[model samples]
Target: MSLKITDECINCDVCEPECPNGAISQGPDIYVIDPNMCTECVGHYDTPQCMEVCPVDCIITGVEESREVLEERYRIISGQKVA
Candidate 1:
């Protein structure tokens, strides 16, 4: 599943730089995670860096997706041939 920044986000600007896939960005009111680019850090790290660094714990899993789906997204995002 992809992660999402909730309204509880304090806009502390901590999560943006932490996203390995460059999925997180500043929205009109809060930080938003691009689901198309979000792979839950599957290809980049053991865990989602943004969630780890968010002080307010506002980052939460959004759309429900399987690990295989996330891995495919990671491959596509990283320019790897998807199997």
Candidate 2:
């Protein structure tokens, strides 16, 4: 699942930089995660870096996606697609 920053977020500005895929961004309010670019850090790290560094634990999983889906996103983002 792609991690999302909830309304509970304190806007601490830590999670944005921690996302390896650059999926997290500062929204009009709190941070937002782009599911299209999110791989849950499956290919880049053992766990989502945003979730790791969030000070308030406001990051939560959303729209549960299988590992296959996450890995496919990683492959495409990394330019590893067979084409």
For each candidate, give its TM-score against the true structure. Answer: 0.95, 0.93
Give lDDT tens digits, candidate 2, residues 17-79.
Answer: 888889988899888999899999989999989888887899888988898889989999988
Worst 10 residues of 2 by lDDT: 74-83
Q: Quote the RMSD, in angstroms, for model 1.
A: 0.9
Error of 2 at 6 (Å): 0.4
Off by over 4 Å in 1: none
RMSD of each: 0.9, 1.4
What clash pairs does model 1 have?
A: none
lDDT at position 7, candidate 1? 91
TM-score of 1: 0.95
TM-score of model number 2: 0.93
Alpha carbon lDDT of residue 31, candidate 2?
86
What lDDT does candidate 1 reach at residue 46? 90
